[model samples]
Target: MADNATSNRKRCSLNAFISHAANTTDVVPEFPARNGPQRLVAAATKQPKRRQKVILEPGHSALDWARLKSSGKDLRGVPQLGRYTLTEIKEHRTENDAWTALNGKVYNMTSYVKFHPGGVKDVMRIAGRDGTKLFMLTHSWVNFEFMLDACLVGFLVPE
Candidate 1:
């Protein structure tokens, strides 16, 4: 009976030590944003637009394929996970939430609307933020004219 009491106390002490260690190391901490009081207050007050989900089907659309050879049009060079129209983007603006980091920085390359060599559809497969890296890596013929056009459009967008 005396040994049992000693064993219970030892067990409780061991449990306490384990709980303390686990709380310190097992948790990853998140940092709060550091901003000036005015900025923080403004940010707190600002109401973000309630976004809705935008769904793009897994495969390329008929419109996407058609735009491939439509030459002499400007298809902003953007990342292509799937094809989406500007109208569709507005309707389902929430999809932009999934791509916040890529937004403003990336453009969708709609080869169908623009003139492209190696076929516009082929380029559409790789239309994200890393256009220069992708272009140089994939050996796609560089078109400064199209790139410049895309840059002009990208610059005009409000951040």
Candidate 2:
């Protein structure tokens, strides 16, 4: 009878130890509340952060472009003249070199670089650039004053 009691006590102790170890070491609870709201704040109250415009460098590598091309994605859309791939734009420089825009426009800002509102240096970095597969020139010229905005106007120049 004593032997039986001792064996039963040992079994109960082993089971208790296993349960305690599981509760202590386990990271996730066995069951979590299913119907709780995922997000606490209302969506409308959150203001989305605006994307900063990229100040392009001449001969800058188009990492995003290369990735898309490697993935077998279609490289459609208009060109961005001042914007270019690092490899493609590296060939052009000096007075005669130029980069083409999406709508077939051309901007030779090398000489006019100084005249840029953002200063000539910024324009030169992106001018004579190439390999830009996508650009925005769809808006009406009257909607945004060209002369007032140099970045916008640089792409607006006709070929």
For each candidate, what TM-score against the reference? Answer: 0.25, 0.25
Q: Write the per-residue lDDT of candidate 1 for residues 1-159, one digit (tens) a residue.
A: 999999999999999999998777564534443565766787779696674433444344545544442444544434333443333333322222111112223343333223334444444444433344555555556444444333233321332
The digit string of per-residue lDDT tens for model 2 on 1-159 reads 999999999999999999999789667643323433433334336687674455544433345423433554322222342534434434555444534333433334333333333343444555545423322322234222222222221333322
Candidate 1 worst ten-residue window by lDDT? 92-101
Whole-model lDDT for model 1 versus the true structure?
0.43
Off by over 4 Å in 2: 1-90, 94-102, 131-159
Candidate of highest lDDT: 1
| Deviation from native of the Cα of residue 126 in model 2, angstroms | 2.2
On a 0 to 100 scale, what is the lDDT of residue 158 in model 1?
36
Task: List pairs with backbone clashes in candidate 2.
Answer: 58-125, 59-86, 60-86, 78-102, 79-102, 113-120
